[model samples]
Target: MDWEEHAARLADEVTDRVSRWREPVAAVPRHELVPRWWQQVAGEWVLRDGPCDLEAWLAAAYCDTSLVTSIGALHADHALGDEKPTGLPTSSATLPSLVVRFLRHARLTQGLDLLDLGTGAGGLAAYAAQRLGSRHVTSVDVDPYLTDAAAGRLARMGLYPQFFAMDATRAIPGTYDRIIATVALEPGRGLVPVLRALRPGGRLVTTLANTSLILTAWKAENGGAVGQVERDWAGFMKTRHSTDYTPGPDALLAHARQAEGDEVTAGRYPVLDVSAAWELRSMLEVTTPGVELHYEENGRRRTACLVHTDGSWARATAEWLAPPEVHQGGPRRLWNELERIRNRLNAEGQLPLYGSRLEITPDGVCHLSRGKWTASLGV
Candidate 1:
């Protein structure tokens, strides 16, 4: 079939995934949303625009997957195909599958007041407003241009909502019965404003950054929200107030490519695909901020560093390195904890990470439960 046929099929699928009221919104052409996006080619991020060929553009737009918008998290708008290894992906219209899953989790109802945080491309907002009524929906993002562009797309579709360009960390204007965040929340106190904006008996759905933790909370009678980790998956881009997320493979990849190490050793243990381990990854990111893992040499050697703004450093180098020497200077033994967690997973064949329970008290100190090992949320 042609792009139009595929778009119709995709629209039907998305409508069924969201709600009946969203059919028209989903039917709006996908090519319209992603008229132009950035893709990494030969390790360089370049702007790729369509609407030239209907078929090619439709294939990219209607498919239930994410298109890379910015590489290295920097604006790919002016990238001259000079930046290497791309950059950490800054933004994109998240895959349709993930969007569907989140909308289902959100459970939008007709005439319900909704708030879409991080209105990337405004697809989800379009989907939400189609069912919930455009007047009842509000979308906010920190990027003014992003919001403006999404607003323009919505206008083309004849779907209108109050699109505001503002930081989510501050007090939003109105109360919302449902708030869905597509951007990950900052470590602590950043989500308090989100919670504050929710009206009583409201629904809050969002995903933690860089991890698989998908959280859903509902406003209770007494002004607090309580909910557990959803038994599914979702991920959001890390929230950014600056130009881009700082310090990642961009800085260290070059260092590793020409490092003066003794030898490239074979790894002792099987490498774990960290994406499959959501809770453990979330806990690790919070407990050891700025920790990035690097695997090299036929996937044998692993060097992970935990860097802090205080200049304290902890480095762990494991290979078929025999003893797996762990260097340390910070107050905390970051590598030791990782090894412990690794051992825990090994001992039980799996950690009690997933399928655990979450309880959010009124003050937002999330208490996580896993058998007998209870832990605080904010680390």
Candidate 2:
């Protein structure tokens, strides 16, 4: 198959919307970067080998969608045909449109040094290296295997960018004119290094973990950064320090699934999947961090579950649009907190998350303020 044709088509699709990234989008051979990926089938991860199915491979590679390359500790390239590892996605070839969106947010200019954090499949690195010289781009990931693999793939295309195997959240090796993190950065010490790595007046574009708010800030003379939460939103995996993420709140979720809580009451609102509702999810995360959300639907019956690491859990169940039956337990009322956010949204026309003014201290604490409302995240 002529993969260039698919690449051109993808360029047309992405560049038609984001015209400035047309050159890199058209030039980078995305198929070469992601040769194998994982696709969900019947709720299980099934490996898709590109070489075996050229047509399907080209379609997925050139499509404007994320292709998971690693789940848990398993990378698609090394997975056996029958192996189906189940866990959160650790790496992926992020969708091309979103990649372009992030680069656009950086406001790239010729000769500017750029750092592409979370170099999973090297798609972003490839595009950046194509636009800016390879020498001007630096890509880093916690997985050395990822950096090595991305380097090999990029070398094949005659695009060689600096690739490092390091946890950027802990320490960034070098400073750059622009730093764009595709991975989500939690507020706290992790963010401190990122802010310190930025040269004064340099631009930083990234998302905070658990929320879809895209934060674009510039380093200031005060050692802190100043910017606004863009009116845009994007979700990304949180930065991990190891091969696989530590165990999630599965035990709490299992409890939330069935156990009768200390407080059982009729919910004022109908059951809604907080995870799928971006605005509500962001608001809840800002107001109360570290809440894990899950939603289930069976025919007309719907259920939403919220689990926190502090042993707090909320379960709400209902049929279709009917008001939900809520159960809450532990130190905090998770469901009630969600309801309060929903109530505020109903009372006010909108939530003050997006388009809010952001003030980041040198210590990496973020303060978001809009009108009379204010919220802070990080240490």
lDDT winner: 2
Q: How well does each candidate superpose onto the true structure, as a TM-score?
A: 0.83, 0.98
Candidate 2 Cα RMSD after full superposition onto the native fold (Å): 1.2
Instruction: Tell me the deviation in Å of residue 267 in model 1.
Output: 8.4
The candidate 2 region of ten consecutive residues with least summed lDDT is 14-23
Cα RMSD of all models vs. native, in order, equals 4.1, 1.2
Candidate 2 residue pairs that clash: none
- lDDT by residue for model 1 over 132-250, one digit each (tens)? 67898899987776788888988887889889988787667789989998888753466778878899989988766656677788887766677777777666787777436666544
TM-score of 2: 0.98
* lDDT against the true structure, each candidate: 0.67, 0.92
Residue-wise C-alpha lDDT for candidate 2, range 1-379, written one tens digit per residue: 5777788889888876557688788888899988899999988999999999988988999999999999998999999999979889999999999999999999899999999999999999999999888999999999998999999999999999999999888899989989999999998787898888888899999999988999999889998899999999998999999878989988999999998999999999999988778899998988889999899899999999999999999999999999889999999999999999999999997899999999999999999999999889985
Count clashing pairs, candidate 2. Answer: 0
